[model samples]
Target: MPAALHPDFLRLPVAHRAWHDRAAGRPENSRAAIRAAVAAGYAIEIDLQPSAENRPMVFHDYDLKRLTGRPGKINAFTADELAATRLIDAEDGIPSFAEVLEIVAGRVPLLVEIKDQDGAMGPDTRGFEAEVAAALGTYAGPLAVMSFNPHAVAAFHAARPDIAVGLTTSSYRPTDWVFLPAAACDALREIADYDRVGASFISHEHDDLARPRVAELKAAGAGILCWTIRSTEAEAAARMVAHNVTFEGYRALIPG
Candidate 1:
């Protein structure tokens, strides 16, 4: 599939895990959370993983115990099996990727992060790339795919160069590469490589917000996005310091 023309993701502070409220509704990647984000007029970022039957669903953890109280890996159960499992404390249930895209249709853009192998890209990781690409074919709104694994992003780009891809890294490491403790040289090298390979944006942890290295990347025209900010103060700080901010559980912090 060709990459679709994406809108400017820099416009709004994206909600990293949707607007999740465990007590009032489901948490991240649940249907309720995605809906809440749409209602709040914020874009959302979500993780995509497949079920045992090769169905794509909105979820984060590899195991089901944390969210569903089920004792197994997400890939161990079919979509039907997952649907039968109750999501902890929410009135709504786990949602398939198709369902999520349908509900949020044309409301807000989604930054779909493919959780790569142990936070790095390697062959041992499951083939989430193919499933994600397949599911995305059904989507009709603005969307971008991001991953900490360059290989994952590379694979997705290879499959669909038209879709905007964001390469995620942490300041704890260098931005040039996707691995931990990435060297500065590696960051520069990778930025060039990603550009040559067609990545549209770059996302890094907030800890790297004020670093000179971040400014360097931004100067080079890599669309910058900072993540996992959980407080209003942090969001404010990010807005003052970064190009785009991704906050988890703090949609209310964004001014209407």
Candidate 2:
């Protein structure tokens, strides 16, 4: 069997984008939302992408219009520009990845998802994957980096093997990998090839846990986590297959 999974990582309920509750005035990935998660005692999960400056910024979506009402790509702005942009419904502005680490202050573990638009290997891409790893260098907290792109994961591992890393995957459909080459799409659909990237864990889509490779990994003791668990029914389903869950919308069902 593989080594034991990190106890704190498995035992905690991770807040998807920091317990975002827009109706309550906190927007997803906002500093206010993150603070709410810290106060509520849930672990945090956030996305990181590079600004035009190549500094890691705490935000999701390749485009900024959804969350910020901004009209350009997120990477079009520099870190200072992004920091000045406020979330649509909240006063808090976009924050740097370093700022988030400081805000969490090791109060709880963090799962940092590195959004990789460029599928380049190694640190040459100047994408958020490398920047995220670089930013994490001085952080003295429990954290893990994950990505949908295997090349990004492998490249980050090559740069910083000390940090925990994982792969985020789902059973792929045509619409999902439309941007990728056919061969790449075929490989991603297999999902178990995550080992190519040295992923110690797999944060799989909750509904796709029944894939044979996933079951095989779980049986061999690889840490298996699931994402965006929103309701009691989904949580119950995920609990049966995943060691931990990244959840939102309501309080997660804690494990014994």
Candidate 3:
């Protein structure tokens, strides 16, 4: 039988990018943010971008400019260089997935989103999923991996079938996805690959949670989670559809 999403993931508010706060010295995916989220009693969500050596680095952007104040693509650097690169105006440098895993230490659940390696979500996505699985081997935690690219999710499930895997979905509106072709967006928007990929859940775009297909997935018993929710009101509304929320920018009350 396919693995299922763990029940603990649905019970707590997840800290988007690990409860990041730049002014507080906790940049997204930084060790400080991971520590802060663990301290706050919330499940943590993080993104992994591949470094030159295919090492999974805890980061969000494909480029290093926004986060590191540098002017190159992140994968241009090896794992060592990426690990040494510091986040803009923050004391912490980019951390490896293994380092972040050590910090969390299974204290709280972790939700990881693998940034799409295949520029257009194509099959050329390298074996980064294999690298990620190797790094996660020692982590005994309540955690799951997901990606906007269904191909990556399928690859990850193949790499570690014992672990629950999922998709990070969106409406894929053309205006918002100018980089992806309309056909690709239309195909992804339907989330038709969820079953074939062996996905157990989805962390969907919060504003798009009301989409009919999202409701259909919910009805079918997929564990529903939503992302980047920023306020109490939005959290309340999302709760009507999502089993749990991955939030940022504000404190979300833990549901009773």
lDDT of each: 0.74, 0.81, 0.91
Put down candidate 1 lDDT per residue, 36-67, tens digits, no spaces.
Answer: 88998888888877788767888888898998
Model 3, global lDDT = 0.91
Where is model 3 more than 4 Å wrong at Cα? none
**lDDT for each residue of candidate 3 in 127-159, tens digit (9 for 90 to 100):** 998899999986888989999999999999998
**Model 1: how far residue 243 lies from native, Å:** 1.7
Cα RMSDs, all models: 3.8, 2.3, 0.9
Off by over 4 Å in 2: 1-5, 119-124
Better of 1 and 3 by lDDT: 3
Error of 1 at 73 (Å): 1.3
Which window of 10 residues has the lowest lDDT sum in candidate 1? 184-193
Better of 2 and 3 by lDDT: 3
Q: Comparing 1 and 2 by TM-score, which wins?
A: 2
lDDT of 1 at 17: 71
- Model 3 poorest ten-residue lDDT run: 83-92
How many angstroms is residue 178 displaced in model 1 relative to the true structure, after the best TM-score fit?
A: 15
Query: By TM-score, who's the top model here?
Result: 3
